[model samples]
Target: MTHSTRSSHPRRRTTPRHPVSPRGLRTLRATWERQAAEAGGPGGFHHLHGPHTHGWLLADAVPELLEPIVHADDDPLEPTFFAHLDAPVAEALLARFAPAHLVHRSNGSPTLGNQLRATVAHPGEITLHGFVLGPGRCDERLVSEGALVRFEADLLVTEHHAPGCECELLWAYAVDELGLDDAEHAPHRIHRIHRAEAPDETWWRLLWA
Candidate 1:
């Protein structure tokens, strides 16, 4: 019964503009594994990466925290809500919902003032994808409260460009609302996968691969 307060905006096309071939998908997954291994596993890679990040949370918390702005008009699991959030509130929410294996990215030096902030691209689109992960495999899952959520946004990057560049940003989190009895259900982890200000070349390659 929760209602979303944010006004509607254009939804991004579900299909990728440049779809990856089956081989490309394999290569992309391999590269991700290699990068993760080299960087001391996924936790290390996330830390070494730039400011963009993602994380996991219990699906139930989504309604509790964002009830005012997460309407049930659509698939409750795919409810659209505001991405921008207050810094303290964002931090507290993450802390409360984070799983034991959730490794937070380093915010870099305080003197440089490069801390991660909760901001979103306005005049753009937001999209979500769902997946399920087991010990050594991952498979797409229908968008649901119990599935892992991949949150992505396409927005303009104006920081260093007179004419802003359009780019994609991504992050992910997991939820377990189904009480699935499987021991290998996806882990509850959240990670910031990419940022517009500093895009990861590898991620771009994978997208276009």
Candidate 2:
């Protein structure tokens, strides 16, 4: 008679029903950890720009995970200015997810609609997808899944808006102070801004304004 021994290891389970891709999750998690390690004082936010989407990601103590808040219906340019201005929907969105954990993304051209959309969707996941797969493919997936709808007019939207909106200020800073022609270059320019020893008062005003 021979005795047989059984292995004690258990098989790992997979979640096929997860809404976001594994790559996206990993990218987001890694980004969060990196930002957390690099951040000083309270953890702050980081910005991302994908071919089809752009938005902010925050690092904080408590992690809050939620579905990517899709804003496919709203006008990415005009409505965004008012959305942050005492709007109930915006308030509710913030209340659900702390600004640190929220992910926001929008559709439009890199210069106009998309930039403004990312700007307003703050305090902001399609952003994660964009980072993982690059902008073009991410946009295709979102569009096929009905998470985004295309608007030709988004390209025509202007950068300048109401004074309190901050869009104009951002545009001015990027163009004037940073001397960047394209909004797509903001991340690189931001690094330069960070490395500067004495970035002047205008830099502060445009950034925090």
Q: For candidate 2, give the lDDT.
A: 0.26
TM-score of 2: 0.19
lDDT value for model 1: 0.25
Q: Which pairs clash in the backbone of model 1?
A: 4-69, 5-69, 53-192, 54-190, 54-191, 54-192, 55-190, 55-191, 56-189, 56-190
Query: Please, what is the TM-score per model?
Result: 0.22, 0.19
Which stretches of model 1 miss by more than 4 angstroms?
A: 1-62, 99-209
Candidate 1 local lDDT, 114-203, one digit each (tens): 111121111112222222221121211112121112234444434332354442222211112212222232223322345464353221
lDDT of all predictions, in order shown? 0.25, 0.26
Candidate 2 weakest ten by summed lDDT: 143-152
- The best candidate in terms of TM-score: 1
Clashing pairs in 2: 51-135, 102-124, 103-124, 104-124
- Supply every candidate's count of residue pairs whose N, Cα or C atoms clash at under 3 angstroms: 10, 4
